[model samples]
Target: MPATIPFKRSEMKRLAEFAKREGVRAEIEVNGFVFRVAPDFNPVRVAVTEESDLDHALAEFDRKHGYS
Candidate 1:
């Protein structure tokens, strides 16, 4: 919930956890969506008032060309 910065390995891990607690979770990327791996854990469908998220951007070079 602050300024942006470079994506660090540690930050990614923590971000993933924070998302889990907030009831928004994902397994990995498939298309532009994060697919879920777990079966039991699920969140309710609702909107948020706060504004903060892990801005995960796709690799420019990879997107332009083909497979990464």
Candidate 2:
């Protein structure tokens, strides 16, 4: 069995415009000491806070699975 996924150009454009208006430009800031890191699209940066959070989550997941 298969399902069809429709791609609407107009819808995409509208969504992009909306994102731009909402300041949805791809960006990340990873300053270890800074709390206000702007987002990046080209060669985006990953904020330290985000990385730390993800690291903690992964550690917890691994621990649950008895991963050393």
Candidate 3:
């Protein structure tokens, strides 16, 4: 299973704004770990596209993208 990283929407928005204004990716160090925030990343959405079978969709995507 893939690991998940959590970020607050407000924090992400602030980072996004900073990156956009500075024209660079925002970097932060927490503990011994470093993370670069994507300027174009957005987690908030008004609606989601429904999927009938997510497994099949992911399998197809992997097959097409050459992912194991």
C-alpha lDDT values of all predictions: 0.52, 0.60, 0.70
- The residue-level lDDT of candidate 3 at 68 comes to 98
Task: State, as a TM-score between 0 and 1, how close model 1 is to the true structure.
Answer: 0.28
| Each candidate's clash count | 0, 8, 0
lDDT of residue 42 for candidate 3 = 62
lDDT per residue (tens digit) for residues 5-62 in model 1: 3445575677577666776654555345443422347567544432222122345555
Point out the higher-scoring one by lDDT: 2 or 3. Answer: 3
TM-score of each: 0.28, 0.39, 0.36
Q: Candidate 3, residues 5-41: lDDT per residue as tens digits?
A: 4556686678878888887888766655565765564
Report the C-alpha displacement of residue 19, candidate 2, in angstroms: 23
Better of 1 and 3 by lDDT: 3
Q: How far out, in Å, is residue 54 in model 2?
A: 0.5
In model 1, the worst 10-residue window by lDDT is 49-58
Q: Which candidate tops lDDT?
A: 3
Winner by TM-score = 2
Q: List runs of model 2 lying over 4 Å from the truth.
A: 1-41
Off by over 4 Å in 1: 1-6, 25-68
